[model samples]
Target: MQNEPLAYRMRPQTIDEIAGQQHVIGKDTALYKMIMNGHVPSMLLYGDPGVGKTSLAFAIAGTTKLPFIALNATKAGKKDVEDVVADARISGKVILFLDEIHRFNKLQQDTLLPHVENGSIILIGATTENPFHDVNPAIRSRCGEIKQLKRLTTEDVDVLLKRALEDPDKGLGKTPIKITDDQRLKIADASNGDARKALTLLESTVFASFEENGVTVVENGTLDSLIDRVGVFGDKKGSHFYNLLSALQKSVRGSDTDAALYYLAHLLENGDLVAVSRRLLVMSYEDIGLANPAAGPQVLAAIQSAERLGLPEARIPLANAVVLMCLSEKSNSAYVALDKAISSIHSGKTGEIPSHLKDTHYSGAKELGHGGYVYPHDHKIGTFGGWVNQTYLPDNLIGTRFYDPIDAGEEKRLSAIYNKLEKFKKEK
Candidate 1:
């Protein structure tokens, strides 16, 4: 028999054979009972790649004795789907696994919904993209959603690596493979918590391992080279994604425009445009709030434009927005203020909004003097006198400055405005 690819060979045949995804697949769960009872639901498994979505579907098929038919949204068409449903009718019970189900256009997805709803076929749709956004609502409504968790924690990765190292039939046991503590740590590090990618990397390392001067072992050097060979990140789904996120956050915090730009490039090169846009959107407010309030708006607009115009054309607006954010003045005063407020609440220091600031729309509110609140915007010179409401920010912190403006274009104007406001206050 021809040797199967390590991915195929390593495919888990049962729930016991599976790794990770314990939250959903653990004992006596609704989904688990369905799998064991041969009555699994028409479901959608959504998460990052190589996190066992497809594997779980196959395991469900194996456990239920259901006829399994696999389709790819990237390739399958209306005709292909129709044929699968027709076959499922004769097969008695079927589990039709559709990979990258999000890529299916609306009409194609709509065709599957009726068959799934009527129980002609138990549909197992899988996608790396969020099904809530990417899957057609009609199809989504007909299926139970199972969100596969992303890779996290070294313990999870270690458990997976040890299993792969020991499983003789499916893992590196067929060949002479041994891992040192450093190699194990690096493997775990490289995987970021994704078992499939870790195993693949482990297999590659064993293949690369050779006897040097009659000393045959997969040591740290061989493992490092294999890690590089497996790619900058063995798990494209996990650590690599978060590493770039970390880099982006640090760039914004350190006010390094160049570093932020570099992180953007890295994310784009890895085909993670969505992640890049998301971080930029977050960094805009979290790191750049108040100092350059326009930064968040600009990032959001860029993302909208990118959605309207994709790839090469879209790249320009995205890059332009990133550069603008990097060059913009940054402040975390909003974050700091919220943190203080949260801490105060946690410490049981919560205070009610003063009567002057409270709503006066109700019947008895006017009698309670709620409507007597001063309108600061309508005051002469646009500055109210003795209108201080120290209920939320505390008496001592009433005028405490937080957002110190930098020399960026917009912030320079903001600083000037603040200076002018201070002069007015002094003259009052």
Candidate 2:
């Protein structure tokens, strides 16, 4: 317990201890009352990371004193569901906290249907993405209600920080630390409504500022050093460089060519081709993804040309890339999908690679259950096709699709291909 991070150690034991999300976990809320009564219902919890999804699930189980089994959809397979069912058989009921529940494909979700229907395995699904957009309809329909945990308020984060500083058992109360109230608030503000981030910063400040005499003074300079981990555009916190980059990206993403060009010129005038180029490349994929597949290479080419041309001349190719990004059909579906996949991984959802997808080039690989590799080239569907319905993901994440192309420009064609492949896979 002492070795665990402060955030983990400070997780709310019951919903009452939860910092924010009053609308759901407040004492007067029906959900709070239900959990207090030991009625743990199957439900979906969605929100950005660090907003207490897992904490809420754990708090519910704690309040109810029920068997809590936490698993991640990207890692857990049917066997995991069976384990929960088996636990329910003995305990009469079990709370299965399925993190990244949106990653559960059809087969895995289907396996839970009977158990969920019988009230043996009460499902508590948690995800950062919109459940309706990613979760299968069957699971969504069965869940009582999809609850969204909003980001923690600054006040809420500050409250947690203070609590952590004072709580001897689960926090840093044992350490002799000193910090101004303003500095504390600054930490909260820097965290941007993330309690975990706030705690991490507080912990960092304590350790970095700790003196040889067993005392710590958390100063603004120490905080600045730790908080500069983000904002690649600037060395100082909240500098104009960061503002320009943010404005530039937002302009391009919003399809404001004029604004995008304005910011690009401002950045170019500031004389940092590398930063501007890096941002343009990101905008190509992050803002104008598959909708304009060529935008990536086009922007890359522009960057290379600009690099060779240098300075005032570099602005020419750079401007071209910027305008192209702004006017192009915009779609963030690609990165959104990837972000969801990344969120699942961050939530400890990574699983072993499926046997069929494992490398078979090594000696004695077949004896290790790494056989049955399917060559997609062998099953060509149609023209412009070297594809087959194969399980390329881990067995648990078999049907998870991490690249959801949108209906825009070339991505429309990609979406069509994706839909066709999905249909074919389902048929098979």
Candidate 3:
């Protein structure tokens, strides 16, 4: 026990000893009750590393007094899972803790389906990635419960730190170390809500302090070295990535510049340039179309700039585009118009094209009554040569209005000209 790392030594022996995750493991909660009753179903424990997934599994096995078989899915093969299943068959029941379960392929995961479906093995699959995307659907469906453990809060980290300092059997109580509340919080902040990481850093800092000053006091300078590195908290292929991208796009569409910038910072921090550029480009046309015609072009230019400049520097141009998109007069008129037109066609309202509007450049087209097409340029009205009131849509959809522009931004001036054209056609 003394040779084990501080994190391992400080593993919670019971559910009551587990810190954080009160929502799932608190008293009277379903999970808590399940463990207390010793009837835990097959479950997938998912979250960022060191937030007590393995600890929770151990706690459940301890409470249930079931034979706990631990195996890392990253390196474990079908044989390893089969061995556990075989043991469960002999022993009646077994709790198998498979860590990094996402690393297992479909074949490796399928090996446990039969045992899991039977009462042979109660599988507790743990992963940092989202189970829905990374785990096989068959394996996931068999796991009756999927609980997400969130990052540890500052308060939770504090509890762990204090417990470690005082626990004689499993922690640094023998070292007589002293850590201030502020210093403990700084360590927690640097840990990024990982309990294992926090305990590891605390243990290392204590050793460093003793080695340097021959004392057990951790100084601010000692911690500064360990916490300087940035810990990015996101999996690009997981749900966190999509959720952030959705927030960024929605913020821009809703014209909330500050919120857009906030989410953009997170994307840039995560090095998701492609998602940032793609989502911003979509926002330019989908949310700001026609209302601010220049917005789409400006966003395209920004995307090009970002692609050329690449990260760190790319955030500048992307930020500019995001601000412009959020501040621009917003409209979805063109998008809505296209959808309405498509709906009409899909609903079988598409009538035959006017014979005059059909191509007359082909041979015999004129003889087929595809002639006398009205040329709007021959009767140009405005300085730039506007069109006549000849029908461009199908005859049945002649009076159907689709592109209804709101009186916002550039659409206001265009709407005035459109109203004028309608009045002229009425008079004629």
Stronger candidate by lDDT (2 vs 3): 3
User: Candidate 1, which segments miss by more than 4 Å at Cα?
Assistant: 211-216, 232-428
lDDT (tens digit, per residue) of candidate 3 on 1-428: 88999999999888899899998799979989878887879999998888999999998887888999999988898899889878988899999999988887776767877888986899899998888888878878889899999999988998999999899989998876767889998888888789999999888888877443544888898888877754666767666778789998899888899999998998888887887788888889999988899999999999999999998899889889999988899889989989998998899889989887888887999788887777888887868595777666787877788878789999898888878877776776
Model 2 poorest ten-residue lDDT run? 230-239
Rank by TM-score, highest first.
3, 1, 2
Could you tell me every candidate's TM-score relative to the true structure? Answer: 0.61, 0.58, 0.87
Tens digit per residue, CA lDDT, model 2, 64-126: 888899999999988888888888999998899999887897878777878998899889999
Candidate no. 2 TM-score? 0.58
lDDT of each: 0.73, 0.85, 0.86
Candidate 3 lDDT for residue 77: 87
Shift of residue 189 alpha carbon in model 2, Å:
1.1
Q: What CA root-mean-square deviation does each model show from the true structure? A: 11.6, 17.9, 3.1
Lowest lDDT block of 10, candidate 3: 208-217
The C-alpha stretches of model 3 lying farther than 4 A from their native spots are 210-214, 340-351, 381-385, 395-404, 414-428
**Top-scoring candidate (TM-score):** 3
The Cα error of candidate 3 at residue 318, in Å, is: 2.4
